[model samples]
Target: MQKVASKRWKLAEKIPPEIEQALSYYPAFFRQVLYNRGITSTEQAMAFLSPGEDFHDPMMLLNMAGVVERLLYAIDHHEPIAVYGDYDVDGVSATALLVETIQLLGGNVTAYIPNRFEEGYGLNIEALGHLREQGIRLVLTVDCGIRSLQEAEHARQIGLDLIISDHHHPLDEIPPANFVICPKQNGDEYPEKNLAGVGVAYKIAQALLRQRRKELPREGFGLDLVALGTVADVVPLTGENRLLVRAGLKELRRGGRTGLRSLAQAARLNLGALSTSDIGFGLAPRLNAAGRLESALASYQLLLERDIQQIGMLVQHLDDQNRERQKITTEMQKRAEELIQEEGFEEILFAFDESFNPGVVGLVAGKLTESYYRPAVVGHINGEYVRASCRSIPAFHITQALDACADLMVHHGGHALAAGFTIHRDRLAELKQRLAKIAFEQLGDLDLRPVLRADVEIPLGELHPEFLKYLYLLEPTGMDNPEVFFVSRNVRTSNARAIGADGKHLKFLVTDGWITYDAVAFRQGHWMEAGLPKEVDILYRFEMNTFNGRESLQLNVVDIKPAGGD
Candidate 1:
């Protein structure tokens, strides 16, 4: 196993006096936390903590007027429509959201999610032709097809009307579809640019519902799906995206969706008390497992299933598949790490082999990036072609780098920090060389180590149980909006022991002389082998832990080091 990389802890600067006075009613810690998130005034803090559903007008999206008009006309004319979606959680949930919206609107609609191993990502000529043959007159994509320039032309040639709705970063030129909905596209003025694919679909659903205001099917019906995809896609939880997820969490906890309820039961999560962490670590992975191992159709169908028995069966299958996925990811990540150790870390890491499962290559690449704090590309070589997933750090714009090497790739598209591509196996060497050159140009002079940002540094005694309530104000935290972490230095440790089935978690008691609290450092059990230091510095999240009906304050340690060792 590779040694853990030492992280640099950057503490947030103290809040300015004027802003602190503006937020004077709030606790000092909460005020600092809010300021750290760019909340300056009382209005901004109030709006952030208790956001109202003042969602932006969906019509603001470019081409949304035409797309909604076309869709309403299709409903009136009884035209067949297909919602083409990708196979990941974001894609599958977006597919379900739009399909259900059209069905509720009384339009003849069906869902089309291509098999990952077979059709690959995004819109494909073959899938479009198949949909056209089925007498589908219109195709609307969700969570994909922002870069399907050729496929859009193919659809038009086949006399199929296409509306592309995707949140991925588009290339210099977009598809020639009848309508395109993307905030990042040129000439678009949508305020929220970080929406997940399912989010874009929700906007379409909103526009469709607005047209039939008197016959609105339901309120917040699709927000659960929106929340699932938005969180699963790891988009920034801020602005409108934050409001959608907050409302979606409420909808999810209501247990209206049978498939999601069944999934929650299987995952041992209390649906009534579900949080974003549960979605990110528990439910999203299970839903993604179906696509990662076999086919995502099962997941898409589960979301729409009304039968209890069928939902149970699907949830069980997903659970089994998720377990298998974990095994495969662990093995593949080990192999990738071994390869990196043998070849040494490059500007960007690459590990490709025929034996690597295409389904889990992205996961392996993510693991490598996380372990080494660098961009990583892991691919599966199949015959003459290699398909790869790239995970990158902030220093590098992964998609732009791929764009620099476009001539060497079959096709590629994704966000700045994550991307996917396929290239002829023969040109793999040139692609790597070009990509490394691009990465080195941007990242060679930077300090590339991982950073752990703490909102404040204080004595452990100052952390009170009442502070937990203030922390709860920042719910639905992920990606850009993160959970607050604190740095407590010169803390003494005692009763240290390795816990967990694999003995990979360190459990101990920590104190700053006056106040003592139980702390757990996950995956830090190796510290015991080296002898636990009597004095240590820890960066952790302070929260309440309930064990056997007893609730007590606990410190969830994120990183630990010997006191004053730096």
Candidate 2:
């Protein structure tokens, strides 16, 4: 188990007085949070808070004209098109988004989600042959196919026109497809370089809408799916992503998609008041469960399903699959932990197992990164090949590290924090040796403890009602931007008790002399067992907790320590 003292609380930097005093119009403490986000001016702050203030030009992407021309040609010619997508939420959502849009523009389209257990990721030769047999004349890949150089060649050989739309780091050699639209491609200038896979797909749809001279669906008809995939992939919630999510959440609150509405009901969520947490923690997990343990078609269909009965069955089945996936993940995580302890974990960790599922290794790597605060690689050894998934810390870029040793991999690509690759099993030892050396070289002197940064240090008594409302102004925060958190010093824990199933959480009554608040710390029940100090400093966020028809502000404590240190 990780030690509790491993956390470090960092106070936000203080800007110049002139900068802070100039923007005295907004809430002071909340404005400080904006300042921390590099917003020194009121205009920047307003644009960040409000959605739709600025929109990037979709046509600016490199080869946007070619992408539009080929796709439009297929649509006009009435040729069956395939949207080959990954099984994860981002890929599936992009597939659904594109398929629906093409159908709206009168085109024959089918979505294909590669089976994780069989095809792994991206294009496979056998799937291509099948698509050809199914009369798929043109292929449009959503969220995948960037690195399928050889497969793209084979598709052309078989008389298939392939258009790839993906958002992953490309290797030296680009694919041989007709048109590849990725922000990372050379000469591309889409402005926001950090769009999720679904975000890229949405841009294509938006471009197609403009090409047809049609008004964008007022609700961004496809935007709800955008929000689901964007949050699920954990992309930086800034730039165009923030605008899309801000609007998507409003659309989700309307509960228009029958399948998504059923999913909300099945998850026991209030559909009318959805938030980022509902998508990331609640909905995205279920959607990913389908891809992890079963064929992702269930999720892809769920996104488009209008039949209420089928939607209910699909959600119930997905919930069951998610439970099984969780159990397997727990077991694998325990084994991985044992291996890490046995080997003595370093700045970077590598774990391999024949039994590890390729579909779930990313999740395991993510868990390992969170628990150990280090970049991690978890892979499944399949015969002579190992398909590995990597999760990274903010201090290190795992993809760049993989790039440094790219020759050994069959194909490797992904973003900074999360990536995947396939390599010969024999190269595992060399890869480990090379990566450990890189880790030491890159992170030898840097502290690895997780740092929790608070917006400002303020007394609990200073939290006025208006200030709480102002906090909501910074909604849909993730990645680069974070939710509001404040530090309160010298607080007394009036009462502390273990709550939740098996007493895994700490329910406490906290006070700062002037007022008392009901506070709960999830997954921190050990604090109660160790016994809280008489006086302590706490990092917390306020929330409106509803119980028994009553609503009251509650302290969602983030971290705690003795009054002087954290």
Candidate 3:
């Protein structure tokens, strides 16, 4: 069995006296939590906790006017448009949103998602040629094509109008599309720079809706899709994104879309009281499983399906695929670790095998990074080329490292912590060496242990049911905005035992001398092997768990250690 590594606990710094006083209207605990999120004044705290409905003007996005004008012209002229998209959730959601938006506006549009195994990611010349042959006069790309210089040129040569609306990091030489919408591009001043691809598509939808208010529905049209994609992409939930998600969650809980409503039921989720965590762990995985295993068109169709029977079939298919995906991921992670142990760990971990599924390699890379606390690259070596996905820690920028070795790669583009690339199998060794050099230069002296951060340190006795109200304010928390975690020391433990079917989870009772509370530690059943400690320190989230319609307060322990043991 693999030994559980010790984690470093880092308590958050206390708020400044002045800022704390500024936010004195709230309770001290709430004030501290707000201050931890960089909220200094009363106004910022209110806005952070309860975001407003007003969004940044969609017209602010660069080339928005041109793209809108061209799209409107296409709508007016009845030009056939193709919504070209990638296979992931972000891309699929963006594609669905844009396609639905255009279709609702009396435009003729169809979705064209690239196959993961056949066409790979992003825009491709063959797809553009096919679209042109099918008489698609205008092509609108979502979640991809920001770096498709060659594909954009091919579209121009084929006499197809192309508008690229993506949120990925763009290359120096932008794609020569008819119009481009990316906030990160030079001279673009859209305030929310960290939008997911679906967020970008939502902005375009907003722009179009502003022009055609007569056709607008009573409630927002695509906010549910926006929420699904935004949370799934794992972007920072701050600024405009937080506002979008807050509104989107409200929209999602309304259960307006039949497919989503059925999906929630199929996943055993309460659609009426959906939370961001529900979307991240429950909905996103099932939606993404379709693309990871087969084609993503099923997910897209499910999102737009209105028939109850069709929705049920699709949801059941996705659930089965997700289960299969989970099993494959476990096997792949075990193999990756074995390969790494045989060759020894390095600054950057690389595992490539022909047996690795192209769809699930990214998930394996993420798992490796979490287990070893280093940048990891997992790939599938096919006939002549290899496709790989990467995940990294904060200390090293994986995408920038890929950029430094751009000459060896056929294509690569992503954010700082996640990326993917394609390379010739012959040059794989050289690419690995170069990336290792870059990783060492950036991370040579850093201690690489995983650090678990807590918002505040308090005794277990201080937790109360009423405090849950304040915690609710931090709803839709993810990425940069995290949930509140508390560290309790020297808490007495009793009634400890392994609880899941596989005995992988721990259930116990914790007490701070006078007060006792039920606690559940997920994936920490290893501690039961040596008998439970009499007393231990725990870092956990205080939450209310509802089981069989009974609500009870519980500590969702994230990590635990023997008291005073380093």
Clashes within 3 Å, all models in order: 0, 0, 0
- For model 3, residues 1-566, the per-residue Cα lDDT tens digits are 23228788998899889999999998887888998898999999888777878899999999999999999999989999999988988999999999989988999999999989898998999999999999999999999999999999999998999999999999999999999999999999999999999999999999998987746664868999999999999999988999899999998999998888888988888887898999998999999999888899999999889888888899999999999999999999989888777656467788999999999999999998888888999999999999999999988999999999999999998988999999999999899889988988888888777888898888787877888999998888999999999999999999999999799999999998899999999988988897889999999999988877788999999999899876
Pairs in steric clash, model 3 = none
For model 1, state the Cα shift of residue 6 in Å: 0.9
User: Which lDDT values do the candidates have, in the order given?
Assistant: 0.91, 0.87, 0.91
Residues 89-193, candidate 1: write the lDDT tens digits: 999999999999999889999999998899899899999999999999999999999999999999999999999999988888889999999998999999999
Predict model 2's lDDT versus the native.
0.87
Best by TM-score: 3
Off by over 4 Å in 2: 1-4, 215-218, 547-549
Instruction: Score residue 428 of candidate 3 by CA lDDT.
Output: 94
Cα RMSD of all models vs. native, in order, equals 1.4, 1.6, 1.3
